[model samples]
Target chain A: MTRLAVAGVGAISPAGVGVSTLAEATTLGRCVAAGPISETNVAVLKKIRRSAAITLYAATAVEEALRDCGVSGFADCALISGVTNGALNFSADFHHTLVTEAKETASPTLFSESVLNAPAGNASIIFNIRGPVYSIIGGQSIAIKALMLAATLIETRRAQRAIVVCAEERNELSSFCYSRFNPKAARVFSEGAGALLIEPVDERRPINPVELCTITGYAAYTIPGSPHLALQRAIDGALSMADLEAADIGVAVSDYKTATLFREIPTLSFSDCLGYAFCVSTMWNIILAAMACGGGCPVNPLFAAGLKKYAKHSEINHVIIYAAEEDGDASAIILSRVGASS
Target chain B: MGIITSHGVGVEANWEKIKAGESSVGEITTFDASPYRGRLGAEIRCDTSAPVSHLRAGRLDRASHLLICAVREALGVAGLIKPGIDVFLSLGTTLGGMLSGEAFHREVIEKGISRARISKTLDYLAHYQAVNLFKEFALTGDYTVFSDACASSANAIGHAFGLIASGRYDVAIAGGYDTMSEFTFAGFNSLMAITPEICRPFDKNRTGLVLGEGVGILILEELDHAMRRNARVYCEITGYGVASDAYHMTSPDPDGKGAANAMAMALKDSGFPDIGYINAHGTATKYNDLMEARAITKVFSSGNNGGVDIPVSSIKPMIGHLLGAAGAVEAILSIMALVEGWLPPNINYVTPDPDCNLNIVTVGREAKIRALLSNSFGFGGSNAALIFGECR
Candidate 1:
């Protein structure tokens, strides 16, 4: 089993540009409405002006994460980005132009960014991550898969470190489709980007450092089976990988309604305030989980209160993050505070 | 392993056509191609009479149809159609259901938004193909969808190889597929990436690449598991390496360092002094062929046999470039070549450029190759190389 260290975290969410802003907003029990990242906020990267929102969000979050980690360059770092619709706005525009207008009128720039891997490719170009870059497409669980791939890459010595980013950009087409399918949940549509810097765990590194959280295990399961059963299996697999038990998990982070599974543990839902930004939801959960384990405030006040209430009496060493999609896909990862006993 | 290409709907069919040096590129029939500059493509000739048996059978897009058929063939060959097995699925695609999405959008434009179906719109997402497979086969294990342009499926296969090599899963069904769509065709045409005539890889007069549609699937099983079940072992995936150029979004590095690094990484991981054959990612584009040739020469210049005679060829001229499915299909063809002692030719090779100075296989050559390398580079500067060795 390869143990990976969460070295840094960054997010571009409804709360604003930084993770601290998100955490502060959650602490104050405020929900920032989802909107596009302003042009001024991303003007630092002038090249991004011609790029799509997904690329902009990813570049911003990745830059912040690199700075937060105090890393000067990422020449040897691998990138694994999870995207749901990629650049949907650009694609819709290009497609609409092709269908309604003349085929020759399709913007070449938009077509280039329309591909699903464009964001990951642009991120690699902008961040100077020359190592292997992979673009995974799925719903919420894709972020967990990205983390798993990152850990695997590090364990196999493919790279010394990895940057995993998940970004989503909401568009009218997507909003309309979702509303048509499930009107009740359409109001919660939002857009954001989240990133994590993970490196292999080293015994010589300082323990319990402020910039460290250890990801001990990860598990993913699909369905044709029951959703509950899939979730249980994933959780059990993660626990076994971590060599821990259900009772050992002190704080749980998930967008799923997991009250039945973790009845006694403090469960935090980042999506409660951030809305269901499918690609960013799970990564946000990981960030929030790390914060909770590090004794920092979360973006949700109720979750913050839960963390405080649980930590006052217990050590809150182990935090398990769970993410499930309506399609019956589930993923779980176990993170422990540095210096915590296995 | 199983494959379905424009040549036909089976591995043997494609191999036969490939051995005959027959080109599958023809006029596009899926849609009206009159408006596009490059009207030629390798489209799958689907039989409308025999339909796939599923709830959304008829509504499935070309990509999904190709994938489902290929998976069925792969599972049949591997004899693992039953459920309750821990078989992971990793699929790669570029367009997914864009054809269906385009049709739906056109309907929305003509009729109204209320008439557009949510299901059709949902199909546009790249992961929907994987979801369809999950439901179709009742796959309960982990699944991933890769959309890294032309390198997508190769990355999927590489990930599967890693998972099995790491002993995470005993079996994995991995491959890639994409269909010819007007969206992609127009995009490539607009970018002038599509060749108006036949694709000619490594040819001095080659213009560009020809888009194709097909699917390839491989059922990768652990050595012990396959032996216990007495399964047919095609070849062992010995090594995989992926890297980025970090240069340009669409163009490759001129010096070919990025591509060479990926090949070197794969070679190092495999610990193979020399490979018997190489399936080059010769996309027929001027820059791609030149860079790939340089990369190949740079990595294999000091060959184990004291000569840089590693026979290399690209099957793109025969089957056209399948984009996302190119890697997986070419990989399958490479494995077939290894087993059958046949070196697939780079058809339509007339004049060779001085830059691509390596030995190019112009005709079918019989050689018993122990190991082979397949390279796939895509639009995002993503590059992946895989080495397959004779399992015996």
Candidate 2:
């Protein structure tokens, strides 16, 4: 069982920048679009960002995460990011300008920022990170793939610490694709970014008593037509790896309807607050779950027909975050409060 | 191994073309390219996978079509079809489904955004192509897509190796795929990175790279699991390393520090036994080839003149730069070199400079290679190096 410690977390959500804004969104049940917030800041710093909003949002979130963790400069660190469409507006607009106008009139800057991994690349450039930098695109499981790769990097000793970022930028083509593919789940799509700083939990040394949280277990897989079965398998694998049971979990942050499989355990979610920002939604869920463990504040989670409110808590030592899609994509992660467990 | 490049549709066909030193680059016919300065590209004239498929070839993007055929060929050859064996899919792509995106954008440009057919744009997203792969084949395993420009597939394969090493999954499929798009063509042309002259690498008068498209995929199964099932193993993947330059988004660090670190790390990860050949990421650009030479000299210094004089070669001159798919394409070619006892020739070479002081394989050579190293660099300072050898 490989475990990684969460050192710090950052957010650039609809409410504002900072994890406090994410917590406030849960308290107020708010989901807003904060594209211009990151765009303005990133564009003021660099000219290329004006053409690419995803890079701007990702850099803004990564900056907060680096600062939150007290990491000013990079030495032996890696950056891994996840995105849904990766500056979709630029790609769409570039193609529009190329075909409508002459091919020679194409803007070089727009074409440079239109690639899929521009967000990760821009973040590495802004932060001066010299380690392994890459981005993952996992449809609805983008966050899952990013975190999984971070674990791989740490386990293989590729980097001592890693910053995992997941961002989304909404455009007309994105909205159209969402409406056509999964109409029921695509209620309201927004734009934002979520980041987490993770490091290897050194078991050789004494355990840090005040450690915020440790990712005990994680699993990602797919099932052809069985959505519920997919969710169950991921949760089962994660729990088994974490050496815990479903009943041992105090709370569960989930977005899938099949997550109801774990009944009567104070189930809740932050989608109402973060909206359906694809990968960002899952990243926010994980961050909020970490905050609830040791941040000295009880995050007020939003409830729905399936997603429940912050009901009575028993111990709140272990929180499991689960997300799934009807297209058979399911991923689950278990977070253990080190202070509480000790 | 499975591949669908301009040279051919399968591994054997591509290997024969590459082994014969036949360049596949020609004039672009899929779309009008006469307006651009660099009208030449490695476009596939005979697309067997796209023009006919059970996947409704008309609706799918060319990238998706290539990926579908490649995956089918790989899985079928490995006998993991139908009731698919439990496996993990790790894929890589840069401008995925950009041609489909152009089609949708053309509709938007001509009519209006609201009038554009939503179904036509469904495969425009990178993840949509991955999802279509799952739906087309009766695959049941999860997947992760890497998008680190030209190094996308190298990073994907590296992460897949880590998964197997950690005992998480027994079987994994790793590779990359891309299709020629006018958007990318114009972008490269706007940067003047595309050479109007013949595509060449590591030459004094070499112009630049010629953009191409294709898919290169390999199935990675655990040694014990494969032996238990009596699987036919071609070669073994020893190790891989990933690094970022962080100097420039469009260009690499002139000093080649990051590239050197990636190569050193990969060699270190593989225990540094002995390297026989290096498949260089020698893009014909003036800056790229020079930086790569400096990077190679930084790692394997030849001042002592007693080191393992390794031979270095670049296949880009023959196949054109496949961008995201270049890593896996080169990896597949390298493994063939290791197993088939023949090295793929780096054709179109004219002269060399004193700066790039290394053994450059100008023509095809036959040798019993013990181990091979392949490198890939991307537009955004992304760098990766992979090592392969016979099954240990």
Candidate 3:
């Protein structure tokens, strides 16, 4: 399989907007953990009609990515989004109106905004991207799925470029859901959006030859009662496909559930810096990995030590991002910068 | 193939009803529909609980029931319900267990927040609905759920096809499932997109779409793999093309450019195969049917793309719009029509609108359908076209 070029990256996290804030998360420390996004930071998001906070985050992040990519026209690009749940905030509001108030009072616009693919749709409309646009929802692997789908689109020539975005909005319904799904967990539910622009690379290009951001391997599986095994299998599959051993892995962005799965490899906890956002946090992990693959690895001492070896001479890079559920749902993906065979 | 639609519980029955050319829409009985202006829905009147064995069907949401029943039938048809069977499950839905969401909301509105039921929140998320299917069949594999409104399942099927084509997975079960819930019903009604009378696609006096609920599943296996297993081959998925209108949220592009592009792309993707028939997305809405007709004409007209005038029809008139499930179910019906060499009628179609310049299937007729196209246009400007051909 051919590698895909990481044209651009964008994110709107608790610390602030842009990928720079994400790169400085360790140094600046956490500013705000979790809450509703302030309008001042995302004032232009309202241009998209009848948008909820999730759509706002998504559209804003996508706009930043498009701007960062410096591409004026991406009319033929496809948009894929990874969402934890559709905009529960708007859905609950509509439901509340339907129940408390009359069903007649339920706003159709609000109802429209609640669907899972609303963000992708709104972004497509706002950006004039008439190409393929859809949403991916299944636990945490959606980020990997989104990236895989994007790479496939580019590889198959389905689209010249693909925009991969992920967003999660927290509300009362999410709070209730969190309590029900993971009652034992105490981390505050964080929320944000992330986007990446992926394009095909020229095979015969010179200069660095293989110094492009590329997703080398990805795997998804579910193994009941042996979630650890599922995680291990996913890692093994990704590593096997990428043809890299565990020793070559520079750094891993992992949740507590996946931290121990990386036995000897150095791991960075997502919650340590940005709290626990759902799909957006996963996208952030990929963005950091993408940066590292492009030889701009974050300088955090914890991740730097383990990642520095791969950064030396910048020849052949491998980084892993993993997520799992207690019920056996697990997914793993590896990104690398290929200069030579390791 | 497995299906449970307004017509009945099996593919043959559903196909028979479509061929019989009768409107199956009825007054909404599952919930009080008097509040909404359009009180009609193509509800599943049959016994949904009879098809369950793994989970307590009666205790589950109607979405789970429909999906599980359809999947059970699909597994049976595929001869893979036994041991050592592993296939990826990919599904699409506009609303997956929104009834569960309504239930949770009602509980919150009734009792205090502290007493809100936990069971109501189980299948509330769309992803959990897929997990429920895994639990029902005791199946364990990575699954993807696409929630792109109506095109949800079509996209799912296309994704699975891509993976299989890329040698990632050999066999995959893909489809769409949605249960008619008052939440969506009221929203459509509120938007004045639901019609009180029977849906009349391509008709001069078409009002709007009528909602329906059901599940449609198909086992997609590689040709060599299926041949090795000696599996029953239904039809070959030739091409799939997806596009977004980026025009309006509810309405399609006024000129049908997105829809036309999707159709043209599908035809091109299939190497410009001779498309003998088209299963239109025709939602029976004022905007959809006209736009679809123009789109079809734009692709298949004599003046455009060296294409021929293909026979087109909308099955929504007979079974009502299943929303997300419409893609898979309609594709299944298209496959049946292809193999059976029979064309389903576009029921309740009256005087044809002059704006729609094309051959509209007004009655069931015998035709040699070698290849066909199934179109599904979803909310938020999502458009997908799938091409299926006879297995030669």
Model 1: per-residue Cα lDDT over B124-222, one tens digit each: 788988887877777779899898889999999999988998999999999998888888988888888888888988899989999888899999999
Model 3: residues >4 Å from true position, as ranges?
A39-43, A203-212, A256-260, A297-302, A305-316, A338-341, B50-59, B81-85, B304-308
Work out the TM-score per prediction: 0.96, 0.94, 0.95
Candidate with the larger DockQ of 1 and 2: 1
- Best by the DockQ measure: 1
lDDT tens digits, residue span A126-223, model 2: 78898999888865567866887888788888988899999888786677767776777655677788888888766312333335688887887788
Model 2: pairs clashing at backbone N, Cα or C within 3 Å: A304-A307
Model 1 spans with C-alpha error above 4 angstroms: A39-44, A203-209, A296-304, A307-313, B48-54, B303-307
Indicate the DockQ of the complex predicted as candidate 1.
0.74
TM-score between predicted and true chain B, model 3: 0.96
Query: Clashing residue pairs in candidate 1, if any?
Result: A26-A299, A26-A300
Best by TM-score: 1
